[model samples]
Target: MYDEFTIAAYERNGFAVIPALFSAEELEEIERQLEAHLRLDLASAPKGDVVFEADSERSLRCLFRIHERSVFFDQLMRDSRLIQLVRQLFNGADVIADGTMLIDKAPLTTYEFPWHQDNAYQFWNPPDAVAVTLALDDSTAESGAIVCLAGSHRESILPHQPSGVFGASRSLVTPPNADEYPPVTLSLKPGDVSLHHVSTIHRTGPNHTSKHRRNLGFAYHTSRSVCDNAAADQYKRDLEKFLQTQ
Candidate 1:
């Protein structure tokens, strides 16, 4: 359920978790589709194990072509419940498309997503681009969970060092001193959703669990007119091809 404080928290803290958003059936549906897509990719992957993990981070799979890969995910992409949440965050504007992807982080140690803003790879559109992360598993700091600095979205977009959406690191002016701020744990059960602004500073730690920790992130935007970056559109298209071939 959402509240005034919750909305305000997103405004002030840069991220807010809307609790108990997805039903049990909904979570199962997403997982079913995700696993199916993973298997399809595995079938055609090259010889030997294709660890699917982007980097040092362990992963069972990473997929972006949901429509081409799984009907279940395509259904969730336009699910009435998901659309409503997207509408609420983007101010009731119908989404032109769904993006980012369904990411699966497998259990391991010593992997962490360096801090970065979603908009860095994006068009740097302040307050326009948003990502809704749906938890398909319990999110704990040790399990490669999302963490963010509250109110960091208010700042300007920092130039990106450029990495895969799930693999790159953000260029920090000066890594935060120990006395600065500690990362916040985004603990959530399956079906919990967190909506974050594009400029919000965020990162996740390694998934220490042997079991997979999965999440489907819907990058919602009004339209390409709002994105204002042709190169990014190209990048997104390029990413889709990577998914289909994998």
Candidate 2:
């Protein structure tokens, strides 16, 4: 559905931004549904699905498996705009929704996400999944916007270790030297979306602005892709042990 230039940018830079992908009305509806979910449904959400700020239990860090919990989010994952883009990204192959999550970076409460790649946690065999992040609020440098290392997805998965952060559990074993890999801050406005490869190296700083930085992440993989169950299970066990000690 996207032009070659747009697709090419994603391939070249490991990430691409689609400006104003969602209309203001759609965003308003999204906010309304999200508010209802938080107020009425969040209390019953499964453990581990909801994560709070490390130091403040009242401050939310993320809400995972949103599509499974909210009908509005389930339908959102099936939207043609998102599905078509994912298909194009996978060379027209049919895809399946991996999961959806809402990341809320509360001002002065959220911790910085260390540099790492998504595949480190997912362990997808083909490593072709794409993460679609829909900006619910303006993301700027001061708001700890996502920053990606250009072309890093072209490399194999890097080593990762426990980060000790609540929501973000793993981090790159060796942080990327900015001189060797220049970072590109993916600043976006409300209604904008960004797509990134599973192997892309990315991280976010803690929000410094008074405003919150919130985004909805929808991940998808080709129908043929499979997860490395053994590795994934091992990672979970390791993460559990790491968290227990904290």
Candidate 3:
């Protein structure tokens, strides 16, 4: 469903936005399913799957692997529209859905996410994964929209350290200081979808507006790609150790 220009933009900038990919009715159903999941499924969710705001008792920060807990989300992972887009991004190669998550930023209480590459957390060999984020609410600069460094995917994975942010634990050790790579703020409306490469350098600011910033993310990798098991295990150990101090 993507045009040549859009594919070229993704290749050149390491990210691209597709406007109004989902209809309003579809979004309504998605919202209903999300609410149901929160009410009926969250209580029994696995440990570390549901994370609350660090300072607030009731505010949620993120829900990891939602596709495994919610049927609608599970089906969404295999939807033709998303599958076709991901396949095209992978140059017609088949892909496997890696994971899904719901990220929520409560109004005025959320913290900023530090700059980092997605592959640092995933540890995928060759790092060919792509993340597709669907905005449930308008994402503006005032609402802490994602900001990406254009063309930064060409760089190798940089050093990362614990960010101390509960939901997002890792951050870049030395963020790029050069001015040549400009930051592109991705301002999106509801029903909009944005895709970015695994190695793209990006971060989001804290929500300053009264409105909540919520988005659903689906990750996919080429079928030929595999996880670096040793590295992934080591990172998990390090992350667990880091979390113990918090």
Candidate 4:
């Protein structure tokens, strides 16, 4: 549960970390189910509706439309605690999960997620959504835990260019300018969860340590937020093409 101080922190900084919100057992189940789902995704993706990362076929970058892929993820997105916190963030407005992603940073991986805003990729209107990153593995600074700007969401949407990651399109990337916002590391233990506004500037560094940095991410938006179907579709098509290159 969040206290007044925590709520104020979220309101002011556009991000907050709720520690140990989930139990260790729950985190284990999530990781187990995710591995199973990812195996299925890798085996039947592209030819099937599932998607993979842009660079490596074996890396398993993210599982999109995750709610439809498995009941566990569906339940997670609909979990009472998640909904309650999201509603509080949205000022009691009804919320819906617009998207879900399973991000994996393999041990000693060099994947660099340049600082960017979630809204830059999703292109949702009103940009009033919160993303929850639930750590399935211990995320430490050495293991490439996510770094965020304290209150960058309060600023206007900065200019975003193409990431040049082969399959990534202009809309798919927003490389961060580090000088604009101060960065703060959000180290998390398994079962810990961190939430950030859609427009909050954030990024994950490379995994220098020998531990997998796996996280289940959910994007929750109020029912009042509008979707740009055309933009979303284009991104999907671009992503699909990107996967084929791998």
- RMSD in angstroms, all models? 4.7, 1.5, 1.3, 3.0
Over 4 Å off in model 3, which ranges? none
Candidate 1 lDDT, tens digit per residue, 160-201?
553433344244544443334445667878889888888877
Give Cα-based local distance difference scores for all models. Answer: 0.67, 0.88, 0.87, 0.77
Prediction 4 global C-alpha lDDT: 0.77
Residue pairs in collision within model 1: 144-205
Clashing pairs in 4: none
Highest-scoring model, lDDT: 2
TM-score of model 3 (CA atoms): 0.96
lDDT of 4 by residue, 52-100 (tens): 4545546655555678767878888888988889888888888987656
**Per-prediction TM-score:** 0.79, 0.95, 0.96, 0.86
The digit string of per-residue lDDT tens for model 3 on 23-91 reads 999999999989988897678887677888757467888899988877789888777988899899889
Candidate 2 segments whose C-alpha is farther than 4 A from its true place: 54-57
In candidate 1, what residue range of length 10 has the lowest lDDT sum? 162-171
Candidate 4 error regions (>4 Å)? 47-57, 166-180, 238-246
For model 1, the stretches where C-alpha displacement exceeds 4 angstroms are 42-51, 54-61, 124-126, 163-166, 169-173, 176-182, 223-225, 230-246
